[model samples]
Target: MSKEKALAIFTAVPRTHNCAQAVAAGFAREALVDTLHDCGGGRAPEGLCGALHAALLMAPEDRREELRKRFAAGAGSVYCRTLKQELKFPCAECVRLGAALAEEFADKPEIR
Candidate 1:
């Protein structure tokens, strides 16, 4: 899906999505959409930002660290608490960044 469409899903009315779901939606990963159902709102493992967490999970194992580091650099931190309470990074933007990175990997897995 288009990035704008993915972002739109985040606050898409009654069927609004969470950070993780928004990233998964960008990839059109239906199974991932289900897997991340409860992984949002700071509930992702280690309290990682839901969007970052989902993006990392979607990436190839070897690229996960790069994805995480890049995300941290851009978003100020990978943890949801830090992003939200400390860095004041909005969740919607987190979703956007995560989806962007995931799409980057999906589009070109050999770039690294």
Candidate 2:
């Protein structure tokens, strides 16, 4: 999918539960969207607030793993890692949603 669309999906992830990690995962767009929907759209029966938060700030691709590893090594939970330790979340949701926005669009011609 295009970068804008990918970002739209990622940005929308936190509106639900707050797991930004999904946005940075190496998974497919559809899967990530579905996961976000489940968590944000009042469909996450189990719920994953922290994961949703981290995914929002994640890179548009698989690079989020690096953040995940960092989180794992630095903090015990994803929320604590990014919010308390890294202090990356500069938004009300505890994460800087779309921090990698430029990188996700880099190297690619503008869509449309």
Candidate 3:
């Protein structure tokens, strides 16, 4: 998807440099779309935002449960921990950062 279109998905998310970079990188377009759909469909799992980000990173399924545990307290801040440590954006910026990265990654042509 185009970076603009990808960015549109994250319009509601707080914009940040990480998010902008993600959009520029095009890394997790489908995952972000799925996350929005799930969230909109009212079936988003607990700590959905963080889970979505982790999934997009291709985190192992076994790790997902553990990862989810980290943010199970309904604390958005906990969710941000991974993004902050991994991408240098605090929890406040995960949504935007994830979107940006997805867009950025998508815009890149396949290497192989």
Candidate 4:
């Protein structure tokens, strides 16, 4: 995942992509994006987080949990609304974190 690209997508005007969509799309492109949207529900509350989880569903349980923990540690919450309202976490930062984490785990043998 390209952090720059994910950030761009998350911060884009009109904001078509959410944090999950940006990160998933950055790493796996259309396939992941489509899977996320289909599985996670497009633009629903916490949809991005759901998409992230869905994207990594096939990975080992520990790896999936680690990714979730990483996201929570960085964004304060995986949910967009909570991150924004309670933690004041910026969408751009979430996108960056998501992208960076995805990149870190993308090549892992157990991530598929």
Each prediction's total of clashing residue pairs, residues at least 3 apart in sequence or on different chains, is 0, 16, 23, 0
Report the C-alpha lDDT of model 2 over 1-112, residue by residue, as the tens digit: 3333334544574443233333433234444544454343222333323443334333435455554454344333344433443555433232233323323433344445
lDDT of 4 by residue, 1-112 (tens): 2767777776789977656677666665776676555333225444445434533553456687788887788777777557667778666676677677766666675534
Which candidate has the highest lDDT of all?
A: 1
Which order, best to worst by lDDT? 1, 4, 3, 2
Put down candidate 3 lDDT per residue, 1-112, tens digits, no spaces. Answer: 4444434544535642233233333444454444344332112344335424533444344344444344333333333434344445443344443443334343454345
**TM-score of every model versus the real structure:** 0.92, 0.29, 0.32, 0.69
- Candidate number with the higher TM-score (2 or 4): 4
Error of 3 at 105 (Å): 17
Q: What's the CA error at residue 37 for candidate 1, in Å?
A: 1.1
- lDDT, candidate 1, equals 0.86
Poorly placed runs, candidate 2 (over 4 Å): 1-31, 40-65, 71-76, 79-93, 97-112
lDDT of 4 at 87: 79
The ten-residue window of minimal lDDT in model 2 covers 40-49
Instruction: Return the lDDT, model 1, position 85.
Output: 95
* Candidate with the greatest TM-score versus the true structure: 1
The candidate with the higher TM-score, 1 or 2, is 1
